[model samples]
Target chain A: MTADAAVVVENAEKWFGLNPALANVSLRVHPGEFVALLGRNGAGKSTLLRVVARLVKPNRGRVRIWGVDVARDPERGRERIGLVAHQTYLYPGLTARENLRLHARLHRLEGAGERVAAALTEAGLNLSADRPVRGFSRGMQQRLAIARATLHGPELVLLDEPFTGLDLEAAELLSERLRQWAAAGRTIVMATHNLEQGLEGVTRWVLLDRGRIVTEWTGDSTAVRSRYRQFLKGAPPGAQGRRT
Target chain B: MKGLQKHLGLVALLAMMAALYAIFVLAPVELTMGVVQKIFYFHVSSAWVGFLAIYLVCFCSLRFLRNRDRQWDIRAAAAAEVGAVFLTLNLVSGPIWAKPVWGIWWTWDARLTTTFVLWLIYMGYLMLRRLVDSPEQRARLSAVVSIFGAVNALVVYMANRWWRTQHPQPVIAGGEDSGLHPDMLLALLVTVLAFTLLFFCLWKMGCDLERTRDSVESLRRTAQRHLREVR
Candidate 1:
């Protein structure tokens, strides 16, 4: 966490038609912080994540990744960031190897074949790496999604509900690897509904409601667990809202 | 939107209309076919603009795919839409002129068939754009399709001439371009110039409006999400 702030946002505002998805939203995360963005279904968490990913532009605001303005210079900044969302973002028709190859080429990686193979192995998907993604099971596809996101060893990793359909064992394995990812000084920001699963190894917890930050808290494991329980008990009964 | 800009397209239209007016009404009727030759003015002008617009679409689409720029996609779409308009007029007017001159409204002649094939391809290109959702994807797919269409346009144009072109070829005859009488060529040149100006004006407006609409739509989606959360 000593290198620098991996992300910084200030007075961000985003609108969809007449509705405001994000209003005056701002936050800063240092390198290696495993932050969890928790919110109800319509919370602006997804929007803010994408705004930082440079996948979507903000109506009014400033967002910088590794000190580079994402909006002003997206390609330059995007080279340092990785994202996995609800959509696989992988071409369904292409084989996993081809999909990874295309993304690798875009990232300008030189040894794409060797790196793609290693990523597939890391995701426990080596056997299926040559198969088209259309045939992959949900959990299997998600693993490949992670592999794709990390293909270039991005500094900032943004995951939206990474554990959505995984079994308990698979979730544990991913959680363990994610902890190792953070320990190695990579920044991780995940948006998820499974509070208990996401709370592990989190350096900070931020709650969003209706596209606005209701609270942000940081602490040791015990405090975060207690606060997470209280937040869930007090919130409305539904999946957290998505920003964007 | 200002004075000169607002009336620019209209001025071009007026100039073309004037040339057409003089060519058809004031100029002496062709000795060969009397008043029937008057259809040649609009007939050739529309075909010229249509061909030029489609070619522009091909060029812009190629750039769009290579650079992944939104502006090129907008230009391609505008060209395709306008080109289709002019091509339809060309197709219809050709028949109108032919029915009286050749005593036939329809023919499977090489020139006519080639034009028809090109019309179909451009129509298909427009349809393909409508089916795509992402701007990036649209640009990629349209670039490939437009290139294919461009090749088709060239093929059709050349194939008609190489084979026994059933439809009469106007530009070249006996391997030499028959020089149009000075008045007739001047009128034709003026009409083509006018149509080119008109196309440019219309294309500018079309591209401007499309970009605005995209920005507004993204804004609207964000606004809707905000409202739901606030509620």
Candidate 2:
């Protein structure tokens, strides 16, 4: 049962001084579930994603990634999870292939050369694989970042504002990649401000307000925005109502 | 833990008192250097504390890398900062003592040059942290620099022993006898203890300040986020 779930967060509370970031938040994500975290800015969407990534520790409660408790063993937990934040955690001095190769070597993965080659090909940057990341376009950098983050083929992936600076074509390509990853049964959780753009393969939508999960809905993005607007109007602080 | 921290300040004060009494009243003045040699006790004690700080920075830096814990980074940074202040004291006192005895205020001897370089390395470590915005990145870079600083510190300590320079030879570890009055040696030892305790007390304060700075930064970000949301 423990191994079955991809991510489990129970009673997780995070605070920065007196200001609360996550307030008694509990969530469970099954394998292959593509959960899209939605909210206005300062809604703690990024903070919640960071909590699952084990980048920022919670003040109270537990976070388990692939049955491994993050507090007890962060390194092992991190091995199963990949984080792709707004800033690509890549060295701009290195080439696309070199960046991927360096990360693969750091993780001590087998068949590093072939893995780097395959990741570059998969990200559609095979021809420009040797080019330095700094010289690449914004879209190219983000795409390479996505590939670098999933280099070790982690079971769970957390993305924060990945589509922020992408053009239409680049956005389409990233959305297509997301669809493929979801279809392949990888657990994907993305924190996005654009509720409309990347909901094609998203299985669930969870809206957060002031660090609280006020509402969640499944199946499509058809009425999610309108419903969210209505929810926002009546939503006082510490309010809760879950929609399935 | 709170009680222990509170009592540490009191203990450090009492130790400093004993050290002062021993230096001024108990120990006899040197026939050659006269009253100026009294500062030697404080100077040597500060150097000892500074060396201790270097070791701590190295240990904490390695631990931060191995354990991936932020506390270690805070500790290493604290030690380096406190070490720098103590080293400055040593540098200033050395010149003041030298002006009368050696007929010169300063000399670029091996000991002095190496000690100055050691100070520069720590300043670089502190400057690197300030330049970087990301906490994780700052910690990683500073840890590597601190490890290198530790290696340099060993060289600085051994420079006087290895090279024949204007600096005086070792007194405590020089041959069978230290060639000193027993009370003088006793005063020096007590002063070393007092300085060590004082160094630790100041180091703890530095760590606490860093921790508080972290909290303040986090809170500031949270406030910025809320302000934007309100806008």
Give the candidate number with the greatest lDDT.
Answer: 2
Q: What are the per-residue Cα lDDT tens digits for candidate 2 across B1-231?
A: 788678777888999999999999999998877999899899889988887898899999999877657788899999999999999999999899888877888776666777788888878988998999867778878999998999987777577546744546533223312598899899999999999989889989999998898789778886775554454
Scored by TM-score, the top model is 2
Give stretches of model 1 more than 4 Å off: A1-30, A37-157, A167-169, A183-185, A204-244, B58-75, B102-114, B135-177, B204-231
Clash counts per candidate, in order, are 21, 0
User: On residues A1-244, what C-alpha lDDT tens digit does candidate 2 reach at each position?
Assistant: 7677889999888753345778988888999999999888878989898888788878788999888999899989888888877788888898998899989988889999999999999888998999888899988888898899999998788889878877787788778878888999999999998866777888888888878887789876777767766666553453323221
> Which TM-score value belongs to model 2?
0.71
TM-scores across all candidates? 0.64, 0.71
Best by DockQ: 2
The global Cα lDDT (0 to 1) of model 1 is: 0.79
